[model samples]
Target: MTATTSPRVGDEIGPLEVRATTLEDLVRWAGAIDDYSPIHFDPAAARDRGLPGVVVNGPWKAALLSRLLTDWLGESGTVTGLRCEYRRPDVVGGTVRARGVVSAVTRDGAYECVACEVWIEDGAGERTVVGTATLRTRRPETGGAPPADGHGRAALIGDRLRDALRVGAEAGRFTYRVEAGDLARFVHAVGGRPPAETVGTHVPPEAPPTYYAVLDPVERRELQLEELLDELPFAKTGGGNAFNEVEYERPIRVGDVLTVVTTYEEPYERDGRAGRLLFRVRRNDVFDADGHLVARSRMGHVLAYDLDRVAGR
Candidate 1:
């Protein structure tokens, strides 16, 4: 836990015990995040929707992954990148644990970094979320070092990203009218720490942390917008999600209508242990009614359709 613990390959992160989540917990999270989906709050509504019960929010599990890495690295380390795949939905009122194992340690520029394979498990011990994380920590006595001219390497990455861009090309834009009901559903979905001296009745000021999931423009009309993916020449019928990241500038409010713009970024191929893998990156920008930028997301998808084709080429 110190600044120089020097995490090695195969080091354990935790069985960080988190208690069973309850209805009140869900409600509180809903209020805190502004996610009030009835499936997370109204059992009848969930049943009507053919769900097992009120479903736990996917982002809640993602946040738990972040907490696991942060707790393991301590104050001295900084989490540089995190990638998560929501494999399965954890039901409400279930006890879940966050766990991880160090996978590798290497140097990047001035920072020594540790990479971990992390997961969250339900009471039944089934993994609900699986992902990888990268944290920058103090250098170890010996390890793989980054190449010289770190700044040049950074510029190279920027160049690669630029090479992937389609000049003046933009994905179709979509809009979401923020509603009070939507806010309630989102808040209830991400149950978090409740406020002290709980009051029975009041309105919250901001939307839940992951409410941007609702603002995703691609879901509006799948087939029409999916043409964007075709631009990348994916091998299979559809590619699987590799990772997703969201950074927010400010909280979205109840009445702020959001306009979302999607742009396809560069697609790059890298050689992997399995074979050659292609990664496609997309960017989503969210702006409020007044045109103020509010949130940004970068989504990465791994294309495996023509795995054999990319391999050894």
Candidate 2:
């Protein structure tokens, strides 16, 4: 779809109501992501933990928000960044509608991007997840104004940023078997609500695109997904997920042992109205047990901290 055809500010997506009928859906997700927190599948276990009924996975809800944006953006657009905070849980057998509304649109280089306010509402209209997203639609040959270069603000930590970019030169890798429990935990973790009657020998549900982020934290921690900023020698004030985009070559199913290798591109500096922005782009290559590509995830993080303390007297 062309830019004109895509959703613009104030557009609403849907009342896409979804439900989880039995434990099968939750169990399936548990197996997919290898998380058996029990709180997800076992009602007794959940109450034992001092919770209500089965608590939907936070990751699942976040993914649903992504789904809402992607569906609205259509085939020509991409949901570049999705940031959400889990406010509550949608218990088992509960139904909710995924919804989105375009909040703003701005031109980023050659891309006309859409920013949106997204959320999930229960059958009774209570919000369980809330956040904002940034999506990009393809632009015609006629591009917008050239990207800004810091709005003329002094590049305060210019020298410090240069030295910090090279802190981590090596990428990290991890491997794991895609068990049933893994997927189930991952599914609910991201608030996956498969069809109520979806059961059978048909291929099990695939984990959410962002599910891989939690697979193997032990080995991944050393490389710290957020370490790029810590590597910088500056007093960091604020920074977070600018956006995340995942492309799946094929579905990941149960019993498929997978290997993931994470690598980062050089930290590039951009001048934004806020300050000198350094974006760290991290890419992950996921391969099935046979080494065939399963999916790829690109996460963009920004470093735009106040430098007054360090730059000032």
Superposition TM-score, candidate 2 onto the true structure: 0.44
In model 1, the Cα lDDT at residue 47 comes to 88
Q: Tell me the lDDT of model 2 at 158.
A: 40
Tens digits of per-residue lDDT, candidate 1, 1-313, equal 4454577899998877566877776776776676667888898998898878887777777777888778766655789888888888777888888889999989777677888898889998999889999989855334333246633222223344444344236765777888876665556444543333233535486876667766766433431323333433334433467787899989888888888888877677776554456676778899988999999988677755455453233
The global C-alpha lDDT for each of the candidates, from Candidate 1 onward, is: 0.71, 0.68
Q: Which ten residues in a row have the lowest lDDT in candidate 1?
A: 150-159
lDDT of 2 by residue, 1-313 (tens): 2334545678886646676534776776666565668899889999998887987777777767777766555555688898888888888788867888889888877778888888888878899988888888876433234246763222323444433333245367788788776576456445554533334424346765566665533223545544334544455556667777788887767777888777676677777766767787777778887789988877678877555555222
RMSD of model 2, in Å? Answer: 23.9
Provide C-alpha RMSD values for all models, in order.
Answer: 23.4, 23.9
